[model samples]
Target: MPQLPCQGCRGMCCGPVPITESELKRIRKYVRGMPLPARSKLEGQLRFFGTCIFYDQDQDKCGIHPARPAVCRAFGLHRNLVCFRMPEAASGEAWAAGEPSVGVLSADFVWNDFK
Candidate 1:
């Protein structure tokens, strides 16, 4: 797979990501496992409205990358989830979720929900 041109994007495309129950559980575990300082820093960062709650704006990457939702993992690779910065990387096939979304991150879910 090609690397996304994410360095300068600051998670501009990570708004309101839909997540399943399993993904939420995984993220809860991932957050709970973080050291207080690391977790605090991540939780303290200010982001643009509508950005994913777990986006580490300071690091310019996903704070819970290892536990990111399925749609995020398939980003820029599926036709329906194309990255505007790298549209050529998207394939013709759409990405299908293995399960239904329980909530939308940064919307139905938030920093408090992960705590």
Candidate 2:
């Protein structure tokens, strides 16, 4: 499948990725012994518009792409569920029109299927 232009994406899909239990466990394991701020971000305690802690704004990519959560990997598989937040995508209007809402679609997809 053709990949979305996510490299320079404004991180429209980085917000509020509802991870599975196993994904959470993996994150916990990865964040264990890390600094408090990093841990808190991973735990969804320090989000800005629900953006993922691993999203590197400067690089416009996932900091932990190799070990990213299932939901993150499954992103863009369902076009209707994805909000292309690029300037030309007109994403704000799409969201206002109710484009499944962030995290809602991720919650619906089974983690095992993506894995």
Candidate 3:
């Protein structure tokens, strides 16, 4: 299996990043019984402070794994994996455990399912 990038730091990419109305609606269906708080910021061409409640602190995984949104499923693809990714660490312990980074997507975190 592919490893989770950025094992040295807590997953920062797990924030409920800003999303579109259609995207929000679709994901909402999956997360039933809970309000998928669409930020008031999506009214314009931009949104600020998009953060999801599903970001797991301990496991470094999305708590809402089953209902992850489209963007959440497709972030940072087809580009050179950035420098911030795969930073050096004292040990590769996190890598062995397979915990995902918060804000960044590992190359293996493909969006093919969504497409």
Candidate 4:
């Protein structure tokens, strides 16, 4: 699959990510395992309103990428999750959650939620 041109976009398309229970648990574990300095840096970033809490604005990528939710991993590869900058990357059918979402990352969850 083609990669989205995520660099230089600065997480403009990453926002309000919906997370399932397992995804939340995994993210919690990942955040807890991160070194304080690194976590602090990620949490300290001033992202645009509604941007994903784990989006590393300074680095222009996901801060907890390995633990990101399934929907996030499927992004830009489904009709519904198209990246405007790379619309062609999206194909096939729209994405649907395999599990019920516990909450949205940036909205219902926050920096303190992971800590």
Candidate 5:
């Protein structure tokens, strides 16, 4: 069988991702000494939880990505090369219309096959 082109496909799946132990640990470490988020509805809850709790929005990337749990790290998001083409949010006043207008590009992940 042919291998799935993960690199060619950016990590843009539609749903919540699964978390793992090691990744969760890494997040705990990052949050242990960091300050609070710029905006949060769960201020006190975060104190108990630590870290961004989940993916950080501002970066348009994952806060705990490097140390993210396996399931999350293994996300097969579709890669859209043009940075500004994709809108970050999809609800309320932030709803931007349609898919990104940027051309697509493929990348190679040595570890893509590992999972």
Candidate 6:
């Protein structure tokens, strides 16, 4: 089957991306030369349930797409892991409509499972 194009999805996959040890290392190295604000944003993303540092909410795209983690690259590519066409939650509209979106992965879901 053909995979759904992820464009215009507003980064639903970003929130659940599992950062592995090696990916963390790569992200650290990549962010070392970035400005303070950018680095700080990345650091903050390390917290559980926070959005991925590379996700640009404003632009709705990955800031570090070229070097994104393996989990990120593999998201929605498999039979059991396909992306869902949920209503956009960029605003409160989806919630206002009484259709609460569900997260694909839990905040405490072990990232090591994918390694």
Q: Evaluated with lDDT, which candidate comes out highest? A: 1
lDDT of 4 at 94: 92
Candidate 1 lDDT by residue in tens digits, 1-115: 9888989998888889889999999998889899989999999888888888889998899999899998999999989999999999999999999999998888988877877
Ordered from best to worst TM-score, the candidate numbers read 1, 4, 6, 2, 3, 5
Relative to the true structure, candidate 6 has a C-alpha RMSD (angstroms) of 11.4
Candidate 1 error regions (>4 Å): none
lDDT by residue (1-115, candidate 6, tens digit) is: 3445667876666775545456655655655556878645544443324565456666667766666766565455543444566322122311121222222222533333222
Identify the candidate with maximal TM-score: 1
Relative to the unseen true structure, what is the C-alpha lDDT of residue 43 in candidate 6, on a scale of 0 to 100? 41
| Better candidate number, 1 or 4, judged by lDDT | 1
lDDT of candidate 3 over 1-115, digit per residue (tens) = 2344645444466553544445444545544534434211121122124433545445555655666655555443312222245333223332121232333222222122122
Encode model 2's per-residue lDDT on 1-115: one tens digit a residue: 4456776665657765665456655654555545766444534433355565566565566755666676566555544356354333332222122222223322443222222
- lDDT of each residue in 1-115, candidate 4, tens digit only: 8978878988887889889999999999999999999999899988888888889988889999899899888989999988888889999789999999998888998888888
Worst 10 residues of 1 by lDDT: 106-115
List the RMSD of every prediction in angstroms. 0.9, 9.1, 11.6, 1.0, 16.2, 11.4
Residue 23 of model 6: what lDDT? 60
Instruction: For each of the candidates, give the backbone clash count.
Output: 0, 0, 10, 0, 7, 0
- lDDT values of the candidates? 0.90, 0.51, 0.40, 0.89, 0.33, 0.51
Worst 10 residues of 2 by lDDT: 91-100
Better of 3 and 6 by TM-score: 6
Q: What TM-score does structure 6 among the candidates reach?
A: 0.54
Weakest ten-residue segment in model 6 by summed lDDT: 89-98
List candidate 4 segments past 4 Å from native: none
Sliding window of 10 residues with minimal summed lDDT for model 4: 4-13
> What's the C-alpha lDDT at position 70 in model 4?
94
Using lDDT as the measure, name the better of candidate 3 and candidate 6: 6
- Alpha-carbon TM-score of each model against the true structure: 0.96, 0.53, 0.42, 0.95, 0.35, 0.54
Model 3 has how many clashing residue pairs? 10
**Model 3 spans with C-alpha error above 4 angstroms:** 1-3, 6-9, 33-51, 80-83, 86-115
Cα deviation of 37, candidate 3, in Å: 19
